[model samples]
Target chain A: MGGLAVIEVVALDGDDTLWHSEQMFVDTQARFRDLLAPHVDLDHAALDARLLEVERRNLSTLGYGVKAFTLSLIETAIEVTEGRVLGRDVQAIVDLGKALLDHPVQLLDGVPEAVDALTGRYRVMIITKGDLLHQESKVARSGLAEDLWAVEIVSEKDAPTYERVLRRHRIDPASFVMVGNSVRSDVLPVLALGGRAVHVPYHVTWELEQPDHDPADGDFPVLAGLTHLPACLEAMGAEAA
Target chain B: MGGLAVIEVVALDGDDTLWHSEQMFVDTQARFRDLLAPHVDLDHAALDARLLEVERRNLSTLGYGVKAFTLSLIETAIEVTEGRVLGRDVQAIVDLGKALLDHPVQLLDGVPEAVDALTGRYRVMIITKGDLLHQESKVARSGLAEDLWAVEIVSEKDAPTYERVLRRHRIDPASFVMVGNSVRSDVLPVLALGGRAVHVPYHVTWELEQPDHDPADGDFPVLAGLTHLPACLEAMGAEAA
Candidate 1:
């Protein structure tokens, strides 16, 4: 709310905030419903319930992924139908699940341009969570790779990691601005560690990124999205000047 | 694949892997299209493109969340209508957006059960990311709070934080097992810190949670979900004994 300082560093969160990662699963789930609609008289709710049960039972055995979900859908159909599910129905579900895995990753709106704007002024870094190979592949394919100063695909965004990152970048926490959708991960830790943080709410957030602790104070500011970030930084830069 | 040890701890990630957090946006967009279909000839793709453009422009300005996304949807609708949008249409969209904020938080199947099972044998912790208030509320409402020994709703989940959590809990890293859907957050860091990790994949993961780094040989074990976690611990317990 006060006069801004030109942000020297801008760190962003990936996932629902930056791109269309989670929606793909929803679309695929819908596709799964459509695939099995003819063979079973189940509504989306019923189908979903059955699939969820199977998924629950197999969570540790199958883990998470489109393939597992799809396979579970097939298994659920067979179970709900008492093993009378048509072969075509089973096969269709499997094929659709495979198709989901192969679907191209789609970036959310404004991401590229916002990255461009921020990169022009601030050292941009991606502080995200996930598998090592998977997150990196997304960054490389996201079309914003060249614009970033560094991409820290981390396991978590806690204080220690943020400190390590700051030490690695040799940037003062005061000059750095953490920007992302998850307030718990991207903003809170940065602010807690004496870094400036700007929260850009994403369209979707994974449940894990949900915060578990109360904020100490008004250390972090929440914004509408990335569009207003550059202007904020410019204003901050002006104030600093 | 090595013989399991007595499981002393379990950790989890929040986000698409857990529940219906991300789909709300997609559903809202779909609802928006349905609302505007009668007045305008705009299809889902056209409307999505416009909204995407607005979102891109507002990323830095607005940040992320249903509030900004809903506003963007309304703005896009108005743009498509050339500023002649009806009052009812505007109110409907606004209501739809507001409705999303009130949507009940839903947990993925097997989560509570998995937590319950693990709780009987091991100390459970939830090391998720998000706004403190929001995430804590979810934990309180999840019905699994009673099962956990501690919850580290962190802004980040990296090696140092993991070490800190272990120290705080007074548990040996070698005796603990981090179970989560994210490879980056739940598995890799714990394993990197010389702790055992079990990966349970979620249906969808935030882009940040995708693994970008290569595993350093036998860094962790991947499981289907928490259902098998008890057995893993039992095997480990036997081996230790």
Candidate 2:
């Protein structure tokens, strides 16, 4: 197969890759800061510090997800307030976290356009990692659901998990392309399996999505964002055929 | 590729596939019964009922492993004995459960020979799922580590996971074959991915390994045990090629 024929499937990553996720998290954190201000006299920085500390300590014990994050916030609020946090304040904080679940998923700039450009030309899939229910909820609410051929919400994006997705879809690794922000979860593993990947950096990345600095050999391309994705796909497609 | 030239990678599942894992568990349960007889004053049927209850209740919280099983035994003993269980007896029962981990792994009759016969001719991989530390430890201690091309100890062996393994090894799904005791975890997923699978029954299977039955499509063969694995691989190779 030559350049154009080499690539058939284009796997797009969700969360911070295609949407403004971390910014939403920041928004949520700000609300948390406001809710606890009266009781704690703490600023956003101090609240964020306490939340991070609680989150770090509870990682293994609580695992990951909004539920855990919300609980951490409540725990931090109670601690900072010296057990004097009001019930209404606590309820408001909890409601803000829950509200995130229903928030309109904002697609990153040019994402919908890029996805549209690749729609008929390539098989497009949403390959993301998060809590199943939460991730699925995001997909449904995103308004880009119809643009994807399939949506894969996995617990992790390791080599084994990526392989499973490809196999399930019956797409050959040589013919598939993974497009995401994270160097670690998105790019490296897909490249390791002889699959192609395009890195589209997000403004702010969650720590888990950071790429591995040291990687096995492969000329994986890095794009500025979704705006640059179509051209990369065109180049790979031409090279593959 | 032509019908006869299509390559296949036949993955042989260790543990319960070509061995007597469940029997060992049953034996351990019997020992537990014997140990708790004096203090519990429960009949064999009653003891079995209590053990099953403990297993069901702890499935999500504790997961599957020797440690969980041992803990269940201790908890059950305490529950049945109603605080009458002696310290010495408790210690002995715990020790009995702990011994299971260190017990010499005994592959079923004809397993090693079957693997040996196929090793030289096929891309055979050992794919089993469990706690990473415990599973790897068992594989290393089993003395079968030297005979295979690769060993995949996974948390789950769904179709996607198997596909990833093949991709990592640079093999085609059409050329891969999965042999194991599970229909849910092994057989079905491979078939879903356009790969072949062979089912080899084990006497006692962990509850998690039990798969619901579906009508066979002739994509893969189901066999009795490891005794038939060599012939199955040869037949699949000839058919694929």
Candidate 3:
């Protein structure tokens, strides 16, 4: 095909790409801080740092998802309170995690249209990293499952993961385009594999998911929002074709 | 191929089939029952029944895995104790879940050799369900990653799920053979997909995974253990060939 049609497959990230998720996490963290307020003297900043530390330590063992986040929250609560944290408070934290898991999946404006537009000319898939059931439920609830060709719920979104997905789907890197919110996850990895990526910034980015290196340094387009994705991909396809 | 060489692919269940998992869960449940003993008047049977009830209710929402199991444990504790459970006990439950997540994956007797033998002739994959990260970690630690063709970690094991996996991997159901411990999750689903299955009983089966109908009524073999898998598969292959 000579990579003539440089975008035969369009893979988008699930959370914060097609729908809102990190904001829910941010709100939950705020509530988590409040839940520990009366028990511990730590300010919100210190509490967040300590929680992040615990999350980092547990990341290797627990991986990521609501469950891991909840576990880290409980551990942080116990440690911050020196085991004096109240049972009711613990229950509150558990309730918060459950609520977050039960949070309704709200699609970002224009996500459905953009995905549908891209699906007309390209194979579309959701490449998300989180708990399998949780991600699957969100995708099913998002009203986009039927629009996409496949939904990949992975544990991590690194270069190897992107490579595996592409290889399994039998897509050439030169003809694959990934669109997502996280540069660290959706952009750099796909770019590393000689594929193209588009960065659409989400309002809330998880601290751990923040890109260490500036995304501007990468050779990819940063659209104003997911709404601009269709036009952007169309222009790229025209230029390549 | 005329389905002449039946059983082109052999997929094995991870938990209980390849490694000891349910016994660990059984041990954790005992500990959970003990932790709630002093806080409630319910006897062991009552507590067990209540916990199972909560698990069933949460199963649809939380799905399954150690995290779901742990969340159910904490919820059951709080409910049974009427919100009077101690923070220390909640922490204990979280710790139990973490330890289970960190549990060493002990392969069943003859698993490695059996998998190696199967891989020599047929394409082999680990088709298991649960937390994606947990299952991935167990497979990675089980020292079997280098042997198998792929590891499929699913959310639920049902007929449609089996159909999806087989269709995705381009494996014909007629040439696929599934071996696992649970008739409900492993055997029945594959059987419904027109694939052959072998039931290898684990010493301990989770209450939720128990088959309602007797497995004996199904047209599949129930082996004494995984150690006998090779011989059984060999006989079946010879019969088909």
Candidate 4:
């Protein structure tokens, strides 16, 4: 907080941080787990692991997004059902994916206000990693478009990607602050690059996005929600006083 | 040619224009066709039709790039063979995809030089549409990275996408020229946006990328190869003079 005087750029992550994302994936997966349970003799944990295995295996080819997730679900279904997955179940997964895509943009509490508050004072932008069209559409639907300076829909949220974003924008890493939900992605990457990051925990985090280390043990600032952001920044700003 | 003075940005398409892209896809599909041939009574044309059908059907959800193409191939194999596709054949498709991913970058003749010729005079960029990581990796591997201003790996190439790119880069469409292989993607979009486009036709075009209208019959400049680009530009420059 004491080093806050140097901060100039505020980059926000989409998905869970700004809106409800992983919950849709989680809910659908839960239903999928139950739907496929009768056909396969596995319990919930094992079933989850099976789907995760497919997702991890297909990550290189499929990448991340609802389409990839849907494909992975179908593959998982086929694998568990021994290639006997019902046509109806595959249709259900497809429908689930469609619904997720069609899901209305429900911005998290205090997001619009938080972004508005952070806009004029800082170089505000949204740097999210997902399917370009999907992410772009979500941003369009979120109604936060006019408030921010830029929307960077990237492929990943690794340290190098964050560094590249900084480099692209001609922003010094020391003066950038990244805010997001994922410790592995939004928090650690920017932190590693000597950029500041504030973690705002989402209730449902994707398994792959969970950090290896205990997130609580990390030195980066963690806040309960975005509504606390203005106060948090103010406290840091006061430190400069 | 008369509009040469208006040109300020030369945005090149990556895949087929700068390097050999669809050739790899064509080759893999050929191998896949052979692998699936004995299992079905369909001829090569029929097989190609089946694969094309599946690819068209999945284009929306699977999106574009080698990953989607590979998934489409697998799904086609499953559908055509009525779920009788052998495990070895499936492995072959996976290996085919991996091989495509690992394929060496082959720059087209005189591309670097053509881009180099235009670099200093214009705001050069490479704007390609595909899976984000895949296209980004292609640009990195293409060795033309340093020769351009920026590499935009977009979800789609349409008038709106081009408009967005121009807006992002602060480029004027009237002063922009897009060069690429596909008429559907590279040429028409920019042309529709009042930007010029040069068609450098690749021998093998994706079926989906074939413009509905004949490009040869259109008003935009069409060149045989990348080597001819500089002269074509010079002719336009002469018109302006």
Candidate 5:
């Protein structure tokens, strides 16, 4: 057991961790590239970089969400095409945003079993960040609502944000473990606050969510997938015991 | 004082309640009308009506806030203009949304005084509903952050939402009071839950926020302005005492 603290609560990130989400963004970005193909001679990679630039510029004003992404796409189209982009194409981008919002909630393999396994033994909750209404709707549609202790949809997942959430819920960081797909968001912040974190990498990550340095730079356990989460936590529990 | 419940907490609705917000929406609506005039022969009133229709239709999908408003505006332009609206016009609507986001948070007259008057006598907090990041940023800019005990930015202000917030914070409905500008959001929900509410009408209200019928249909005190809030609460306190 050494000096390790026993984990009492397990908190997981919503997007990409429990469900297929980043893949939708990837598909939408592809659709965006296709829509611009006729108006611009640039490669897909170059166009994506330009849209990313617009997103970065608008981030402070628009924050984060499908709406922000859609706005950036429209702006990028307008800029790259030099106003030659037709209004119908602009409308297509808006439809893309709508489709993303109305996308069905698809749970990843082993998600329900992992949550069920952890439910009785530990306080399981979801701590996700994004557009509030959109996230709330997704949680409602996820069918995991009745099994969790609490659900917090924050605007960001920084160290201070994590600290505030933990304090508000009266959960000690020493006994808290955050499992998610983004190391920059769900992993690093929790670890910085003296908490435990498990990384479950998704197949495709949003460029903005990627960490500049190698995620392996951090001292945390990495799981092959969510199916491996329960066993990993149990081993840690044994060590603490 | 017989049977009257003593108020222990004072919660306020942000936006048009503590600051000028609806007027900005009104002004933006005017600009939207102007942008469409060249492409369509419809009068301002008809154009405004069409835009409202689009907003109502998109509410469930887009929820609320500047982003939602902007999306609706873009969609309306495309529909009414019959594909004649230029990309530049769509870009103009996006700029309008950005301006709304960047608009200075102007505290209504005597707001600071009213909040200050209520501060030490009771636990003061803000219960605002809108985009999470946008609402949070507005709070930070409002200069009233230090005076509030807590701030809740929710997606909607329905009865269930109020109940969840009150129960989570361990606040008794009998001892709570909500003050705001929207009768539908700030008044009806609290009153339905046996909590008291005070309505302080703003000069301009968003059509969506307006109640279906007369707001006086409900049983609650109505103040002429925020400056009178402290005195009204004190009288309620005396009655309960």
Candidate 6:
């Protein structure tokens, strides 16, 4: 507890951190590449880069979610095929989007236990960014709803968003710890706002959410997995005591 | 100043109430029928009936919004054509969704004046139900954001939902007023919770939201148009005075 390390609230990221999310996007993109192989020989890297370009452009208008992703896929398909995209290809992409939406929520290593462990001891809420319907679907299907506090589905994860959420609940950011898989969204933003964060790396990450720089010393703690969360919190608690 | 007439907050339904919403759905469905005419000779009424059936079924699974509407169109297209729906039709329907998403928000008559008039006099919030993104798009594009106290994009408009929104804002439901076009969603539910309601009928009504029967006496007040809202509130305020 070197300086204000006592945790009174825990904010969890929905995708990849608590459950498998990025993997679906990854799989969808791979299938997209295969679907268009005959029309173009663009490698996966180049195709992904093109898709990201389209997604970033559409983000302002479309925001984020599976629907936006599906739109980007269709836009990319049209772009690569020079607007000669076959009718079947467009429908196939739509089906891919539907599959992503219909996919079941898969909880990672230690979800309810980690969240349940901190329930009464700390005010816990899930703060995740994505389409509200898609995010709510993940929450409803996750079966982790009752074990935690409210689930906030926001447009983006930034300092202002974090501040608003924390202040609304009357929780001081200094005592708040955000647990998630992205350093860019989950860790750095919280740290910037004087809140604590714990990084639990997933097997795959969304390319856009990757941070350009590394975390410096005293920035935040990195956990091997969610199972290690209670220990980390307890150690911090001991230091504070 | 009839009875319990002082108003502290005004909750407006987003689509149809504050802006044109159902008309867009009607126009899109028209185009859908035309596209499928070559495969099936179903009349507009029959086509609309089938689409509604599919939508009701998907409501539990897909929820609502432009995205769900597009998916339902695709599903209906497939069902009517016995899985022989052309790829071109799928692309065409997707275009319709994008168009709806991209449509400019047209504020109903005197919406700004109504919301602005009530802004400082009461806590004003838009309680809209639909796809969060679609509803959000309308709000963002409506140019009415600055006047609203808050915009609550919800999944359903039931008694419990209205109760939760009111309790969250710490407003006594008795002093709150709900204004919208759907009696089923806006009037009955709010009135059931002992709140007042103002019904402003839209030109077109979605079949699902149409009330099964007429509202009884003392159900709520009815207005000819949104232009009449400020005056109605004033009358109520005068009564309480």
* lDDT string, candidate 6, B1-241, tens digits: 2347578889899899999989999999999999999998788888899999998977765667887788788778877877666655666877898888889889988888878778878888899987666677789888888878878877788888888788777888778889999988988888878888899999988888988655463556789888899889888667656
Best by TM-score: 5
Candidates by lDDT, descending order = 5, 3, 6, 4, 2, 1
CAPRI class of candidate 4: acceptable
Evaluate every candidate with DockQ and list the scores. 0.02, 0.03, 0.63, 0.31, 0.80, 0.29
Model 2: share of native contacts present? 0.00
How well is each residue in A1-241 modelled by candidate 2, as lDDT tens digits? 2232467789988878887777787888888887777667777777788888887875543444554465566667767876666545654655565566557788888888888998978888899864445666688777888978888766567898898788867888888889888888888888888788888877777654455577445678888889888888888777766
Tens digits of per-residue lDDT for model 5, B52-128:
99999999999988898998999999999887788788889899999999999999999999999999789999999
Alpha carbon lDDT of each predicted model: 0.66, 0.72, 0.88, 0.81, 0.90, 0.82
Write down the RMSD of candidate 2 (Cα, Å). Answer: 10.4
TM-scores for all predictions = 0.41, 0.49, 0.94, 0.86, 0.96, 0.85
Recovered fraction of real interface contacts per model = 0.00, 0.00, 0.60, 0.16, 0.76, 0.15
Which numbered prediction scores highest in lDDT against the true structure?
Answer: 5
Chain A accuracy of model 3 expressed as TM-score: 0.96
Regions more than 4 Å wrong, model 2: A1-5, A41-43, A60-63, A215-219, A239-241, B1-241
Which pairs clash in model 6?
A: B1-B239
Query: Please, what are the lDDT tens digits per residue for candidate 5 over residues A1-241?
Result: 1245889999999999998898999899999999999999999889989999999899889988888888888899989998888888999999999999999999999999989888978999999988889999999999999989999998889999999899989988888999999989989888888888998999888888987655555678888788999999998778777
CAPRI grade, predicted model 6: acceptable
Candidates 4 and 6 compared: the better one by TM-score is 4
Error of 6 at B172 (Å): 2.4
Ranking by TM-score: 5, 3, 4, 6, 2, 1
| Chain B alone vs. reference chain B, TM-score for every model | 0.68, 0.84, 0.95, 0.94, 0.96, 0.94
For model 6, what is the alpha-carbon lDDT of residue A205?
A: 74
Best by DockQ: 5
Docking class of 1: incorrect
